[model samples]
Target: MTTVPRSLDEIIASADALADRFEAYEPADADRDSVDPTTALWLAASRRAAAERDLAAAVVEARRAGVPWKVVGELVGTSGEAARQRYGRHAAR
Candidate 1:
């Protein structure tokens, strides 16, 4: 199977799934500072998923509009080279 998802919707769905999984596994501690390592990892994973979804959507829209990957990377605060390295494979499929 391809590592890249087919659409923005799929990316968002993956993010939602990560968020749900985080919620399901989160510790019910009253103090936010008291979260354990596992819980913290879940939180981080949830955040990463959300960020990935947003970035994927932007890349998809930009590609559809004929915006170059380098320009898109610059807009996102990364090198054009890096953006292509990270997202180009997805666009290919």
Candidate 2:
């Protein structure tokens, strides 16, 4: 939850935690039969927020290790410029 993780290990740990939390919820058969739209929306939004946070943390770790933007972009399936534009400012702060 800090601006950036202090190390690659820390980033990985945080990501794992987020993923675990995101996956922890599962509706029972009865609950699934009558799903609450608000609850469903909250779950979806929470997962997305966790994913975005994890990605930003990973980007910071990569940049700290001197990984080039091109490599980062390739890994994430984006152009170097696009990746930088999206994550660079956050890393800078």
Which of the numbered candidates is closest to the native, going by highest lDDT?
2
Q: Where is model 1 more than 4 Å wrong at Cα?
A: 1-33
Q: List, residue by residue over 1-93, the lDDT tens digit for candidate 2.
A: 466778999999989988998899787799767769998899899999999999999999999999999998998899998999999986776
Tens digit per residue, CA lDDT, model 1, 18-89: 899988885556775687999899999999999998888778888888999889899988998999888887
TM match of model 2 to true structure: 0.63
Instruction: Give each model's whole-structure lDDT.
Output: 0.85, 0.90
Once model 2 is optimally superposed onto the true structure by TM-score, how far is the C-alpha of residue 32 displaced, in angstroms?
A: 5.1
TM-score of each: 0.56, 0.63
- Model 2 CA deviation exceeding 4 Å by range: 1-28, 32-34
